[model samples]
Each structure stands twice: as structure tokens, then as C-alpha cells.
Target chain A: MTSFNAALVRADTPQLTRVINGYPITYLDSGATSLPPRAVIEAMSRHYELHHANVHRSVFQTASEATEAYEGARLAIAKFINAPGGAEEIVFTKNCTESFNLLARSWGRVNLKQGDVVLLSEMEHHANIVPWFQLRDMLGFEVRFIPVTDDFRLDLSNIDELMKGVKLLSVTGMSNVLGTINPIKELSAIAHKHGALIAVDAAQSVAHSVTDVKDLDVDFMCFSAHKMLGPTGIGIFWTRKEILRDMPPFLGGGGMIADVSVDGYTPANGPTRFEAGTPPIAEAAGLGAAVTYLTGLGMANIAQHEHDLTGDALTRLELEFSGRIRVIGPRDMTNRGGVISIDVDGVHPHDVAQMLDQFGVCVRPGHHCAKPLMKRFGLNATARISYGPYSLVRDTDMLLEALHSAIGMFG
Target chain B: MAGLEDLYKEIIMDHYRSPRNRGELPTPPAVCTEGFNPLCGDQITVYIDVTDGVLKDIKITGQGCSISQSSSSLMSAAVKGKSLEQVQETIGTFKQLMTGHETALEDGGEPEKVDIRALGELAALQGVVKFPVRIKCAVLAWNTLSQALSELPS
Candidate 1:
């Protein structure tokens, strides 16, 4: 096993040095949003200070520079994801939620009809489920979900029936709450076997591990930059260029037109067709820097480091707290990322999180935008803590101490 | 730490541990109204039986955290057997207490002490103002009580 230099990674992240409540901040909520490194911040600031102009519209030097940075970020993301269709497939959106909306509105609206079905999983984030529900109201398509098994994996027992008549299967590559990494390749194979196009919500997965869209054979993939140590206002929506050419534009205004007349407007070709209005120029630069930084550290090494930390925490928590706290995700390192959801007996997650806050251990306590999944497990909420490249075992040690105090108070 | 102590006062924790008037009452004579904290998934249903402008019985049933459930438990006990006017006054005082705007009004129209004696045990929740995130948790039951009251007649 390759060892990781977590202290070196932490040195790059300025937020890791912050102290709260007289204790060094133990940021365990990276599953919710990763703290950006100084390099990402500097890159964004450089773009804004040196080259600040709207993309694809103006004829000046800064405009060309802005456009170059924007499109260059798309190329960076393409290489990061190993996107088979390359930079032409990348469309910038407000966030991952908007990217899902683009799929539901543009591709889904065009392909799906009244009798068609869009199969999703129980572990999908609300962003993946809600858009299809909204489209269902308009297009009259049926939406079905694959259930989760008791072992904290997607229950595919009835997948054959679930996939019958399904035109599209949209799922999360990794659960934001559970940290269960879904087998996208296997799921995509099944979806294709049933003549359905597969789309992956990579919001949680892309940051933690390597994501090769071509290898997974997913037709569409979307993720947010903020979750991946980048700026908040940017996300990437990648699809096959041929499919994007046929799909209608989701949002319309300037910068997405070929020719406009009193009669109508012809939409632009390729990724720019869906990207209307002024995009997040500085955010794109930040994302470009983020991918560069992640590549420098190496995605596989980051995953291995996180897995070791997560695996250690899991063992320590169960051994120390046994029968007192239950983990909501998988117990082992196999087929999982660093996201850990803990259910402390006889205490509400909010109260538990509040107690942890005193010790400067930041953890998210809520449904985590996956309400239906919460209902599946008879839980309203759980305390979710995840890892990024910079997260350390010492952070998890602080987290355990906090959890012990919280349990002593409430349990 | 002071904020945490003030938030989890013995009275509040006692109410949470052994809630008062926790279940539903017989209805038709009783009218129930529900309110939910959408963000945290705290749903509270207040059941009130008003006979001739007096609350005959008050009960609250819900699933929520300590603050919300305890607030509801304490409120149900406080509002029971009180007149409609007294219930309204308590709700107003509680809201003002949470917001820290105008605490209480003396008969002379001066912004003075709240006469915490009037609030009885519900005054234990006065420390909620310090914890901004918990104000709503402390007020979910009061909002439902207000809704339940408006459903009653003159």
C-alpha cells in the first residue's frame, strides 16, 4: 500500500489551520463541501484581477483570455474525468443540481414520452430525483426507484422488473450521505442491456476517486466544483457530443445563438448550446486549478489515504462505542469512500452535531438532501462526516473524542 | 458552553425526558392543527379542546429534537385549563421572548419586566434567545397552538 503525506496536503489548505473554541478545527464535513486550497483561491483571484471579461461575446483581448480560461477549464475537467467525448462534451452550469435539470429538461424532454420510465435508486440525492419528478408532471413519464438493501447497498433484486420500459437510469456514483460507491459500470451495463441510457450524478464520487466516464460507459455525468475543492458557482455537465447536438437547450438568452430573427433563433452547436448567459469565469479558473492540484497529489493516492482514515475511524468507533453508535454506511473499505453516517442511540443528530461543534469537529446533521433514503432506513437524519485529500487520521481522532463527549452528555 | 447550559436547562430536559400531554386526545370536541419545520423535519400537531372559550384539554404529538419536543410538552401543560385570552398572551410573550424585541408590556404601556410569574414553567425557555438556531425549535408548538386557536369560534 502506498503511504500518503496528509500533513503536506493540509499545509496547502489554509482552513485546516483555523482554530475554533480553543481547539484546532477538525473539518469532517468535506462530504458536504470540501475546503478549497490556496492554489485554487489564487487561480480564481488571478483570473479576476488579470483577465476579467465576459466569455464568447466581446472582441477584445480580455474577452479572448476569459473565453480561453473558461474553455480551458472544460478541457481540464475533461481530462480529469477521462471524458471520451473530450472538451466539446463539457457544459458549464450553476451547480450539479442545474446540470441534472439540464438533462431532465433538454434530453429527457426530447426523448421521454408519457409511457416512458426513468428508473433511479433510493440512494440518489434530491437533485437527481426531483428534476425527473418535475419533468414527469410535464412529460407524463413514470419514475421508479431501486430499493436499498439492509447491508447498505443498492437492492437490485427486482432490477429486471424495475428496468423494464425504462428509457433512462439516473443514479449517484456515490451517495453523499452513505458514502456507498455504486458500481456505475455494472449499473450502466444493466441499463444498456435494457435499452436505457445511464446518467451518473458524480457530485460525491469524482472528488474521492478516479472517474473515467468512457470506462463506466455512462452517457451523461454531472458534478459540482465546490465538493471537489473548487469554487461554489461552477459545475460540469458532460455528455457525448453527438447526443448534446440533438438535445435542445435548457436555458436560452445571449451567447447560445447562431442567427436570430423576428421569426426565431437557431441554437448554437455543441456544449455552448446549453450554456446560456455569462458563465462563472473566475470559478472556471478555480476548477481548472483544482483539477491540477488533485492530479498533482494523484486521485488514487487521495482515495487510498481517505480509505485508511475512514477504515481506522470505523474500527475505532465500533470498538469503542459498540452498541452505542451504529454506522449507516458499509462497515468495510470495499466499494466505499470516506463518507460516514453515524446514528448515536437515544440522541437526535442535531443535538449530537451541536455537541461536536463545541470540540471543533464539524459534521453535517440532517437528511442530506436524500429524504427518501432517510425514510427507507427509518431515520430523519444522521451525523455525516467525510474526508478529502487533506483530511487526516488526527482529525478523526479529534472527531472520536468529540463523539465521546457528546455521548457522555446525551447517552 | 454557557449557551449550551442555558439551552438545556433542567426544566427543558425534564420536559423532554418525561414529556407532558404527549399524545392525542379524543376529538370533534377537540380540534387539531399541525405545523412542521421543513428544514429539520420537525412536525408538530397541537390538539386543543375548547369548551365555551376555555381550553378543556391541550396535548401535543410530534417527532423532533429536544428543543422542539420539550417546548411542545412544556407548552401543552402551560396552556391547558387557561382561557383563550391567556393562551394568546402566552404565545405573544413567548414570541417576543424568542425574538428579544419587546419582552413584556406593563399595564402602564412601559417596556418593563415580563412578570415571568405569568408564564409559569414556560418561562424556563427564556434562555432560547441566545441560541439563534434553536429559536424556531422552541417556537414550533406555539405556532401550532396559534393555528389551533384560530380554528376555534367566538
Candidate 2:
């Protein structure tokens, strides 16, 4: 076990302790969206002030500079994820939801036949499930779900049974609700052995730990920038080079086209073909700066910090609450991330959340967009307290105190 | 200890612990409407049996936060025996109250006041106005009632 004795560094994050309701705020809802660092905000503001021009169009110096900055961001993202075959394999979309929709509309429409099976896990966010459901309704494909065990882990014991006729396996790298980290590399290997392509939704995992796409050998992966201390409206969809070359274009617009005529149209190749119009230039630049910030701090260091925090939170919660609270995910930090979903006896989740808010402590209460997983666990909802790099032990203490207050009120 | 009393007042907790009209109605010529708040996973199913221009009976069955469930129970008790016009009028007045308009109704010709306590146990939810996120939970049942009425012929 890693001891959590690190200093509560307040140098990097200036807005850590904003006042809410006449009290210092404790933000524990980073799983919903992360607060951006000063570097990312400044980078975005700098782009808007200068070097704001359309790329790949003009021969002027401004256009050239803008194009270099935009493509440089792409390369930075590629290296950030250790994407094989360089920057061209990265396609920028609105968010992870849009990225999954693009794949469903483009590659899935072309490759999935009438009887082909599209396998998904029960722990998927609605973004991952709904697009495939829409595709199934339109394209006549079969949708199947991988069952979860009693402890909220993926039931890998029945992997062969579920992978019999699966053509494409879309799984989450880490469950947003349970915080259980799935074995993406092992799952990818299994999918490949069964002659299926795997696409991992790394929305929760990419922010907390290091994700090397090439080493995992996943066919496709998508994640959003908002969850990673960057601005919203920007996410990455990384596909293998060969897969990118073979798939049809997702959206047709100004940039994705090579040449257009009344008779025929030619589409641009690789990532450009997927990006249709003027991209989110400032947001992408901000995401690039966010990657730089994370790299400087070292993702491994952040992961270790989060792991220690999660362990501390669990130990404190279990010790204090004893038989009152039940945590939903793995009890060990070795197999989990920094999210903790908890249910209190005889207390509704919303009531718990409301009590926490009275102390200026923010948390999320609901199914966390995993209704099927909630059904599997036989729970209506759970109150979740997640952490980030800016979180401190004081925040956890506030949460514990507020929870106790809530329980007393109910009692 | 700022416990459930802060959010769930005595009356609200009473309705939650033992909800009124909680069972499902037999499938009759009833109009059924479902309400869901995606943000909080609060859902409700309301059934209205309107016969001969009167709301014969109103029942709701679902699971959600205490505010939502108790509000539904109170809503069922308020409009069960009222006519269609009365139900619509009460709904409009309740909507105004929830949206910060018409905080108090006029009383006996003196603009002095009409207490919302006259609105029955539903008045217990006034505390929800302080918590905006829970406003939806308190109003979900009324919204379902409006939907059920809208589907009727008048």
C-alpha cells in the first residue's frame, strides 16, 4: 500500500477553494467534468487573440501558422496516447459521444451485415449503448451484452461463450459508475482471437492513468477532453492506420473533401476525411496544452496519487460508517480508479447529496448513466464522490462529516 | 445535525414512508403518463381515470427520490375527486407557485395573504424551492398529471 503523505500543493491550481454559500467549496465531482488548469486556459486565450485562421486553405503566413499549430496539436495528442503510425490516425470530434456516433455511422454501417453481432458490456455509458442501438435498429444487426459479476467486474469466465459470433466488441476501459478498471489489453487480445475488432471507450481511464493504444493493440479508442482538465467540445478517436484507410468518410463538408463536381466527389484521406468542417481550433489547442501539463506532472505520479487517495477514502469511510455505508466497486485500489460509489442504509441518494451540498461539498447522485448496471446490482441509484489531482484530505473529511450528518437526519 | 429534516420536512417524510395511492390501477379507460428526470434517475408513472367530466381517480406508482414520491402521493390526494377544470386550475396555480410567481394567493379581499398550507401536504415541498435541482423532483408528479389531462377530450 502506498502511504498518502504528500503535501497539499496549492501552487498549480489557483481556483481550488472557491467560496460557495459562505463556505469554502469542496469539489469531488471530477468524474462529471474536470477543472482546467491555468496553462490550458491561457493557451486557448492566446490562440483566440493571435494565430486564429482557417487551416489548409490560404498561402498566407497566418494560414500557414494556424495549420502548423492545429496539426501540431494532433501530433501532441498522438504521442500523448502512444498512438501507432503517428498523428494522421487521430480524428477530432465534438466529444466521445460524437466519436462513437461517427464510427457507428461510417464503419459500422458498411461492415456490419444483417446477422452480425455487436457485443457491449453492461457497464457502458448511454453514449456507447445508444449509438449501437440506433445502428442495430437501422442496419438489422444483433446487439448482445456481456454480463457482469456480483462484484461488478466483467465476467471474463464466460468470455468464450459471449464472443462466439461477435463482429465488433465495444467495451469501456473503466466503468464510470463502479470505478472498476477492465483489462483492455487482455480483452482486445480475446476479441482479436475471435476475429472481432475492439473499440475501448477510455473516457474515465484516460484521465486517471496512462493509456498506450499501440501496446493495447485496440482497433479503435475514443475519449473526451472535458474529463481530462481540458475544455469541452473536443475529443479524440484513434483508429489503426489500415482501418482508417478502409473506412468511409463520416461527415461531408468543406475540409473533408479533396475536389467536388456535379458528377463525382473525392474525399480527403485519413483523419481529415473524418473531420468535416472548421474544427474546434481553440479547444483543440487547449487540449494540447492540457496534455503538456499532464506530461510534465507525469501521469504515473498522478495515478499513484489518485490510488492513494481512493484507498484512504475507502478506509476512512468504512471505518467511520461501519455498517451504515456500502461501497459499490472493488475494495482494493489495485483493480480500481479514484471513484467511489456508495449507498447508505435507509437513506435515498438525493437526500445524501443534498446534505453534502449544505457543507459546500459537491458530489453526483444517480445511476451515473449506467441504468443497466444499476439493474444488475439491484440498486435504484448511488451517491458518488470522485477525486482529481486538486483534491485534498480535507475534502474527504468534509464528505465523511456530511454523510454522518445526513444519516443522523434520516435516523 | 442538518439531516433529512432540512430537505424532507415532517409532512414530506410522512408521505414517503407510507405513500398514498401507491398501487397500480387496473387497465381501464385510464390515461397513463410517465415522467423521468434524466439527471437524477427519478421516474414516475401516473394513471388518471376520468369519467363523465370528473377525475374519477388518480394514482401514481414509481420509484425515485423522497421529494418526487411524496409529491406524487400528495398530488394524488389533492385532485382525486375534483373535476377536470378544478384539476387544471390547481395545476396552473401550482406551476405559478413553483416558478416563484404568485408566492401567496389573495385572501378574503385583503391582499394580506392566503397560506399555501391550504394546499394540503403539498405545501411541505416549499423547502424544495431553495434547492433548484430538487424543484424538478417536486414538480415531476404535477407534470405527469398535466400530461394525463391533456390526453383527455376537453
Candidate 3:
């Protein structure tokens, strides 16, 4: 047995914790939005304190510095995700949802015609599915979904058949509810072979694992900063430079246009074309700092730690609860991330979550924005406990104890 | 263990184990409306048979958490055989009670105290207010019933 120690476990430090949650709060909702680390918090604070000026207009020192910092953040993000080109290919948006929406509205509007097919996975979060639905309603395109197997893994065996006649294939890199890490590299390759471009919702995977746009060979990928221990209200969209240059701008405003007139207007060059308004300046800096921090700690280490935690939790839950607790998704940890969804017999997920809350143990309960997946699984909802770098064995113990307490209450 | 007593009172368990008005009423005259909490996949289909402004029969069928199921079970029992106005008033009073707002019915009135004994099982759900997220679960059935009544054509 591996003896766990609590002495070395401290998340976000004290100062950063104050600004975020106002106390030493145990935040297990990292999959929703992670608690920002001290470096990220300090970076944003420093930006406000020293260089608080708008970008791309004023010739003053502060304005130039602000522009440099903001553009520098773009460069950092591009590097972090291993984009082939420079920052020019990276577009900053409100969040992952907006990024996918941008692609659907702009790219889908231009490329897809009536009866054109856009394929998706059953495990997609609402963000990925809903945008396509809106596109289908507006543009009269067909949206098809790749079926998930009985074990909840994407059924890649039928990819060849599904990819046929597909204009674009959009899928999630990792399922928020199932914790299934999709084989994006293989999926993208198959989509390409079938003459289709692929867009990946990396909102869950990018933060927890090493992700490279070049390595995956995906046409487009989007993820949020907040999920990766960065500030909220900022996200990244990494696309091929040539594709971005060809696609129409999502939002047309002062920043996105090179020349505007009553009759016609031309869009600005590079990623700035997609950024319509004044961006979230401080938030971008915080994201850049977050990427820097993650780089220092090494994402591989974080992924390994999360994997260990998930594996241990899965083993213990199965052992302790026996037949009473039914874990959703793949039993093996190889193709999974750190998320664990479990249904306790005779106990509702809300009751389980509430009981866990009383013990100061946090876990997410519900469909987790994956209603179709829940329907596919024939379950209303399941309680999900997702792990981060700060999660320890004791935290899992607290969850087990609270779960037992909740079950005993129903008994 | 916090024990079953704290969260699920005996009354609630009783209602859940043996729910009242748990099936469907007759059609045409019965107004059926569905309530869904997309966040947790809690769904309820309320069937109310209103005749001449009086709720002659009421039945509910759906799947949800215990709080939702039991609340629907109790609500069907409480409002059956009452006039439309009385049903409306009871629903309004219950909404106010659940939200912790002051309700005139709590004091003396024509409808009286609503004889909350049928709501016996539902009282355990009062603790749901403390767990604010589950408050929706507790109120889902009543909300659906309210919709069914509002949709009635005078």
C-alpha cells in the first residue's frame, strides 16, 4: 500500500486562494474551471497595476507594452499547443463554446450547403453538439453522430463508413463525463482520408495531457483557459494558417477589419481578423502565465499524477462498494483521463453530491452537459469526481466515506 | 452515516414506497404537460382532469430523484377534487412556502392550512432548500402541475 501524506499538498498557495475563492477551498470542479495558480493571478494583477492600456492604437509606451504583452500571450499559447505556424494562426475567443461556435457559424456558413454532412461523436458536450445543431437549422446541413460502444469508447470500427460523404467531422478529445480519451490522431487521419476536415473540442484533454495540433493533424482545435488553471473569459482556437486566412471572420468590428466603408470592407490579416473587439487583455496574460507554470511543472507529470489518482479511485470504489456502485465508462485507465462517474444503488446523484458537500468533499453530479451520452447510457445522471494536481488519496477517502454515509442514509 | 432520518424522513420514504396518484388520468379533459430539468434529466408528466373549473382527477407519471417523485406523489393527492381557484391558491401558497417567502395561507384563511398531512412525505424535502441545487428537484413536480393548470382554457 502506498502511504499518502498531506503535508506536501497545497493548491494555489494562500495569496492566490484569497483572490479566487476567498479562502482555502477544496476545488474539485477543475474540469468545470480550475482554481488559478499564484503565478497566473500575479500576472494579471501586475498587468493591471503597471500596464493598463488598450492595444493597436496609441503610440504611447504603455499602449505599446500592452500590445506586446497581449501578442506575446498569443505566441506563448501557440507554442504551448505546438501549433505549426506562429501566433498568427491562434485566435482568442470568450471560451471553448465560442470557439466552436465561431467555426460553425463562419466556416460552416461558407463551406457547407444543404444536405452536407457534419459528423460528431455521441460523447460530445453540448458546446460541440449545439453549435452544429444551430448550423443545421440555419444552413440546412445534416448532423450525424458516431456511435459509442457498450464500454463507452468511440466505435472507431465504423469510422470508415461514417466518414463517407462528411464535409466536416467534429469530436471531443476527451469526454467530460466518461473520461474517455479519444484517439484524436487516428480519428483525424481517418477523417482526412475520407476527404473531410476535423475539428476537436480539446476543452477537457488539452489541460490534462500533452496535446499538439501538428501531431494530431487536426484542422482545428479549441480549448478554454479556465480549465487549465488559468483565468476565465478567455480561450484559444488553433487552426491551420491557410485555413484561417480563407475562412470568414466570426465577428466583424474595429479590431477585425483592415478597411471599412459603407459599400464594402476588408478583414484584417492573421488571427486578429477573428478577434473582433478589444480582447480580454489581463485574462490572456493570466493564461500565458498559466501555460508557463504548467510548462515548469511539466504537463506529463500532471497527467501521470491524475492517472494515478483515477486508477486508485477506480480500484477502491469497485473494491469497497462491490456491486452497489456502478462506475460508468471504461474500466481500464489506459484510454481514460481522471474523471470517474459512479452511480450508487438506491441513492440519487444529487443526494450523493449533497452528502459529499457536507463532508467538504466536492464532486460534480448531473449529465455534465452531455445529455445524449446520459441517454445513451440509459441513466438520468451520475456523480462525477474529477481529479487535478492537488487531489490526494485522502480526498478520495473523504469521497468514499461521504458516499458510504449517503448510501447508509438511503438504507 | 448521517442516517436516513436526517435526509429522508419516514414520511418521505412512505410516500416513495407507496406513492399516491402515481398513474395516468383519462385523456381529452385531462391536460398533460411535461416538466424537465435538463441539468439532471429529471422529467415529470402531469395529467390533470379539470371539469367545470374543478380538478376532478389528477395523476402524474415520470422518472426523477426521490424528492421529485415523492413531491409529485404528495402534490397529486393534495389538489385532487378541488376547484380550479383552490388548486391555484394551493400551488401559489406552496411555491411561497418552498421559496421561504411569507404565505398568507400559513395563517388563517378560507382554504385553511392546506392540511399538509398529505404533504407528509414532502416535508422531508424541506431540507432540500438547504441544498439549493436540489431545490429544483423538490419543486419540479409542482412546477409542471402549475403549467398544466395555467394552460387550461378558463
Who wins the lDDT comparison? 1
Computed on alpha carbons, the lDDT of every model, listed in order, comes to: 0.89, 0.85, 0.82
Measured on C-alpha atoms, candidate 1 has an lDDT of 0.89
The collision pairs in model 1 are: none
Tens digits of per-residue lDDT, candidate 3, A281-394, equal 999889989888777767787788889889998999999999999999789988799888898887778777776666666788888999999999889899888877667777
Residue runs of model 3 more than 4 Å from their true location after superposition: A1-9, A13-26, B1-8, B100-125
For residue A381, give model 1's deviation from the true position in Å: 1.1
lDDT of 2 at B65: 80
Report, to 2 decimal places, the DockQ of model 2. 0.46
Between candidates 1 and 3, the one scoring higher on lDDT is: 1
Model 1 chain A: which ten-residue window has the lowest total lDDT? Answer: A1-10
Per-candidate TM-score against the hidden true structure: 0.95, 0.92, 0.91
Candidate 2 clash pair list: A409-B3
Q: For candidate 1, what is the DockQ-based docking class?
A: acceptable
A208-268: candidate 1 lDDT, tens digit per residue: 8988998999999999999999999998899988898899989999888888999999999
Q: Clashes in model 3: which pairs? A: none
* lDDT for A388 (candidate 2): 82
**What are the chain B TM-scores of all models?**
0.88, 0.84, 0.80
Q: Cα RMSD (Å) per model?
A: 3.4, 4.0, 4.6
